[model samples]
Target chain A: MAAVEIHQFAECITCHAWSPDQSMIAFCPNNTEVHIYKLLADKWEKVHVLYKHDQIISGIDWSVNSNKIVTVSHDRNSYVWSQEASEWVPTLVILRLNRAALCVQWSPKENKFAVGSGAKTVCICYYEQENNWWVSKLIRKKHNSSVTSVAWHPNNVLLATTSTDGKCRVFCTFIKGVDKRDLGEGSSNDLKFGEQIAQLDLSVTWAFGVRWSPSGNTLAYTGHNSMVYFIDDVESSPSAQTLALRDLPLRDILFLSERVVIGVGFDCNPMVFTADETGLWSFVRYLDERKVAPTSSKGSQFSEALGKLYGQSKQSTSNDTVEPSKFRGGAHANCITCIVLLRRSAATTVKRFSTSGLDGKIVIWELDNSIDIQQPGYR
Target chain B: MAEEGFLEVENLEAIITRIEQKSRKIESLLKQSKPVEALKTALEGSPLKTRDERCKSANWIVVHRAMMAIKDVDAMFSSLDPEYYDILMKYLYRGLATGDRPTCDQCLRIHEKLTERAGLGCILRSLADTVNTV
Candidate 1:
């Protein structure tokens, strides 16, 4: 049996992040405010409400090392919230973009963060200790459309981003003052800041979620076309493989390990993809194993009369079609938008991961260790 | 601002002219009984960038003709490059949208073969893409 924990936090959550110790979560409830809830005793209690942005909060990430929360908003601003005493203080990062900020992520080192924007640019921001402020350098002109998501390689210097223009690109985000020159090897060490390193145009439709494996040798991303593309040997000769899913398109993806990936989206269930011994990725199975109830052919006369009455009231509709069900027969009743790693069994293996979606419920899924290690390609 | 506007219009005209030339070339290739080359030409610069009905219809006519002229379905599909799969699917859908009986029949035949060869990603990419339309 799959071990899972479900918590309903809001009516609809746009984005969410877990605290370092997994005691608290900060999530945007499809609004301009950020609500931080603490797991008190056995119940979740509201602890803080972060209100600074003028528009809807699009993305949020909590730093694992620094315990700071970084948020980006559609208002074209980003804020880094650090706890001082008991209150959280917000410091604004100067992201000079004329378009809305779409997504943000803290790099592995927690030294700098990258924010994707609608202006076809990504702003890599880092703190200037001398000035005590965050300054950003723009990665410009590479994307033909809005940058949808950003993921950092384990080295924290190479950044991968997906765009609406049907491309996923990896860029060198190593700033002179913020990063060590010799910290990264191969192409990451040699490329200048904001230089495009590799571009993957395997998807012919809008690409949404992107993630790098823990080893940073492989990258995976999802397209709106209900396909997932996995690229191996990204630094050298990049080879891409595409897996087409039969369900609705995935909006976000997470790497559980180098060989296992969990993708969630409009399908309302997390689907797993695994690489074989030959490193060819294929769809495995859904984490949610609940059998969807088949639609009944026989309709009750009362409901049929009601359907006709509703159609007559609306006047423009046919009486034959009934409204679609709100229940998708999965753990999430709506489209899942975000998945964050919660705990790890080892440096490379994920133990527990949490996913939150439009249903406003956060589901914590724990992977059975025995089954994971027995997989064909899993180490 | 005025210069930028004029440049945009001039660029659109150039694209339309280029598409027309490619369409005529595809017709000539079909006349020469080179269905494979004709199909290649039809898929070269697709999907047409312009939303102009005339440019789209002319390209579709050429693509439909090349697809119908092919005698060996399996041989043609076996030789077709994987890179052209998504574009070919798009043209098939555009052909289906015409609602003409022959065009729909030909497009359905090719669509079935292409989906079998390329798997489901080809169809998904064609339907999901809102940016690049034929």
Candidate 2:
């Protein structure tokens, strides 16, 4: 089957989350409400609208193992929704922060989720069986700016957080009561929640996105200065490698294999970056580079000019965030805001990925090992 | 819309970098007596006569700078014809809208020179034609 697009509204898709089975899609339509859609007969039908927040919804994540959805908003609220009696019920996670919740993600174990907020904290929220409510413990005082993005290690004990403060820190979120003992390099007795395990200065600008490698040995993040950085596991000290891109700031990133990463943002296309065993990161190629049709140099550059005019004409009708179409070859006409890996196993490579953008598009790219994850390079 | 704003600002930065690089390339090409090649390089990202189409292109700013470079540049004998001022004007207005102080200043410089070289009569004729056609 070809890639399916679920267009909601122009410039309205803030972010989106997909269920483990890829049957359901939940996205914030640039508002307080989270709209859930189900794939029905090769088309998406709006099934449910999750509402509660009085402000714009910033992020949403669906835990594949738990079959639950968590959403954070600018209203300083975070809700974990579970379906009971065929209706989604909201369980309020008590994220008592001074400012808005910016982003959220579930851990690999589905036992907990992390909410990055404007209050300079990442609230690691977990289910308190005793109280029957989700409770949050703070990873406090580490970040000076609002935490923009967060990713959890496969071990479920460590978290990688990126903040607008120009710092990306790896913290050991090993709660004594909640987390079971796991034999790992950083999971020592001295390790505790909020303890900074390793920190890397990504750039002078904000680190907008971060992702842990499948092996949990490396961390990759995109900086607001249009740079992609990687933190590799080097015995006790992690090594930081930065590759500066010539494009706009990449808003998000995802790993296709251990070495290949796809970054998308203002460039309006997914740029592939790769690393070798030497830990040197470099820009490999762009996924979408629209080839101009070969034409005789005789007449009508006017049509090409008119085509450009017609393309730009739509930008003015949307909100302020809608950029003029730049990626002439990419699927998404605007900046891609979110990207998630579609995987069959935790240990192997991700065969597919999905991206949602300001163009109100949901794009899926399926990969073949020989074609997409090819390791050809200067190495 | 926050996402859009973020993309636009970052894109502006990216576009500026690209324009700076290409403008230098054009300048160098002209210095090497390769005006034809310089024009070709200038037209690389933005298609010829496709001024309005490149609003999202990093080449938009570069195209403007390239146009100005050729117009001001003494390429052996002839400068870029005054007929291309409309294309330059398109980006000039859009660049001004960005409120980039240095860029607007550059545009003003180009504008003064454009009026002077094209002469007030041709400028008025084109302006009247534009107004009438619109």
Give the number of the best model, judged by DockQ. Answer: 1
lDDT of 2 by residue, B35-124 (tens): 646655665554332223343355665555554454443341145554454445445555667788877776676665554444333333
- Model 1, stretches more than 4 Å misplaced? A294-328, A345-350, A372-379, B1-92, B100-123, B130-134
Docking class of 1: acceptable
- What digit string (tens of lDDT, one per residue) describes model 1 on residues A70-130? 9999999999999999899999997999999999999999999999999999999999999
Q: What C-alpha lDDT, on a 0 to 100 scale, does residue A165 get in candidate 2?
A: 80
Isolated chain A TM-score, each model: 0.88, 0.85
Which 10 consecutive residues of model 2 chain A have the lowest summed lDDT?
A: A290-299
At residue A206, give the lDDT of candidate 2.
72
Write one digit per residue (lDDT tens) for candidate 1, span B1-134.
67755765677667667768887887788788888888998778753545566666767777787888888877887778877887888998988998999888888888867765665656777798775788
The 10 consecutive residues of candidate 1 chain B with the worst lDDT sum are B46-55
Predicted model with the maximum lDDT: 1
Interface DockQ of each model: 0.23, 0.03
- Residue B70 displacement (Å), model 1: 16
Q: For model 1, what is the error of residue A101's alpha carbon versus the real structure, in angstroms, after optimal superposition? A: 0.6
